[model samples]
Target: MGIRTLVAMLAVALVVIGALATQESYKVFMPGLLQGAVLTIEIAVLGSLLAIVMGVLAALARMYGPAPLRWLATVYVEIFRGTSALVQLFWLFFVLPQFGVMLDAFLVAVLALGLNVGAYGSEVVRGAIQSVARGQWEASTALNMSRPQMLRRIILPQAFVAMIPPWGNLFIELLKSTALVSLITLSDLAFKAQQMNQNTFKTIPIFTLVLLMYLAMSLVVTIGMRLLERRASLGLARGKAA
Candidate 1:
């Protein structure tokens, strides 16, 4: 009856339409698409792990550590963020071979994805940490908590709540960006789709299939992150109650 209800119904109808369309598209590219989809997931998951680790470390160094540490973090973030991700992959995959620094294609893809996403992610981390209240820090200090203890016990848990939404967006972006790895012969979703188009000449349907596959993957990430956010929020609530 109301506008909110109407909007909800419209959204549901759109989802149903999309689902039906994807079903038709899936028949056009089935078994050939499976391996590429799997590899895409594998790359995205591992790359995201590396990205989170780097982002957190870089953020902490820039925020709380010594001047030299801050400078190093700054340089790392700036270099990766300033440069193109494709260029980073090219250097790692192509140029490095000349210097005998060759890496496996999968490894190169993973590292490039991680480092580039991590650079942008560092700012998210820094901002989340900064968002935690000053009073919380003072309270932890008043309790004679050590720096590490305060960070582990008080600061990080709260910062994590604020970090989830941005990190979710970054994760999905990283997943989509995995398509680039196909450029270097990684045989991911995009590459597989390219092959389908080359042989079948059904670019529209094949790419439509790829789009649905990516959308499915993104949905999974969104749902997982939502669960994580709920858990983090509950944990924060408990910590505050204590």
Candidate 2:
């Protein structure tokens, strides 16, 4: 057999061995896994929510604000997107305490994840909002619509449709990024896996479980995003037809 085939066979054998080893001790893994999953989900959900809100605000600032305001928004986006999330997480957890600001692990994770993702999400949101044609803006103005009214009635509705795909993409990234929170003793999936491996000396089995759990969560997010994308498109089609 080729090297690739040999490697695949060895990988399969390793998985089988790991599974067999962990099978008898399933009860010990279950509680930790459940708790870890909960923490993972909570971090992803809360972080994504904060990211969506801040991203929208940032996008709006960049797209419509005064020159200095836009510059500030641009700087914020660039700074966050430029830095390493792990570094940011560490700062939030460790350095912030030195400045007389104390945050719990969960909050620190949420803040770091949200801030990191928001920078990327802002660009997506800004592009989506801008994708509404220039003609549409002029038409709204010609119809004597105020700026707020134009955005509300003519621009935002369409922009939201465009934003769905990018938002979904950000969510997937956010979900995976939650693993980094384990470093801060958050008891997330990675943390649980580490704990199991340390206690049981079954690193391979523990990590195999972690891999599967991350894969399962990612798949769920992917399917949900696809559904949302379809719904957004369907709404747009129906509106156009009407």
Candidate 3:
């Protein structure tokens, strides 16, 4: 079978093994882990949505906004991209409270990770938009289309296709970064694994399960992104033909 098929089968095998573990073991571990996994999924989904919004807004601001807006967007992009995500997390969770700007741990996790990933995503968007052929811009202008009209009708749809692959990579990176949220007391998958390991001392079994769980999640993301890319590509092709 193909490599993807093999990996998928292996993940399924591991999941089956987890399910078939002793009742005591299953009861001890599975509930907590599944709960954490749910929370992790929640965080990833919210963070990804925020990241997409921020990336697009920042990219548009930097490219087309007035001087003040461009400067602000530049500062945001450079600061977030230049710093460590961990540091950003710590600052949001630990340091912000010092200014009486207390925030919920979950909120901090989503904001920190979303903003960090978004900084990189902004660059991807900028590059993809730039990659669209200048001829398309000229043609749109010749049609007497306004800047926003041209961008909406011609430029963005094409750039969106080019943006998909890099956005996929950034999303995967964002998924991995969710582990850091555990440090701030959010019970994500990594936090659950550590808590289980400490309580039961089933180091190998617990960690191995955690590894498989993360792999399963990343695989799902990869598959979803690939499907999205394929669908976008087909749409782009059709658009070109028409």
TM-score order, best first, reads 3, 1, 2
- TM-score of each predicted structure versus truth: 0.87, 0.86, 0.91
Give the top-scoring candidate (TM-score).
3
Candidate models: Cα lDDT each: 0.86, 0.83, 0.87
Error of 2 at 8 (Å): 23
Candidate 3 lDDT score at position 154: 96
lDDT of 3 by residue, 110-129 (tens): 99999999999999999999
Write one digit per residue (lDDT tens) for candidate 1, span 1-242: 33355345545544753564568555657777878999999999999999999999999999888999999999999999999999998889999999988799999999999999999999999999898999999999999999999999999889988999899999999999999999999999999999888988888777866776787677767767766776778846533321
For residue 169, give model 3's deviation from the true position in Å.
Answer: 0.8
75, model 3: CA deviation in Å? Answer: 0.9
User: 58, model 3: CA deviation in Å?
Assistant: 0.6
Worst 10 residues of 2 by lDDT: 1-10
| TM-score-best of 1 and 3 | 3
lDDT of 2 by residue, 31-133 (tens): 7887899999999999999999889888989988999989999998998999989999999999999999999999999999999999999999899888888
Number of the candidate with higher lDDT, 2 or 3: 3
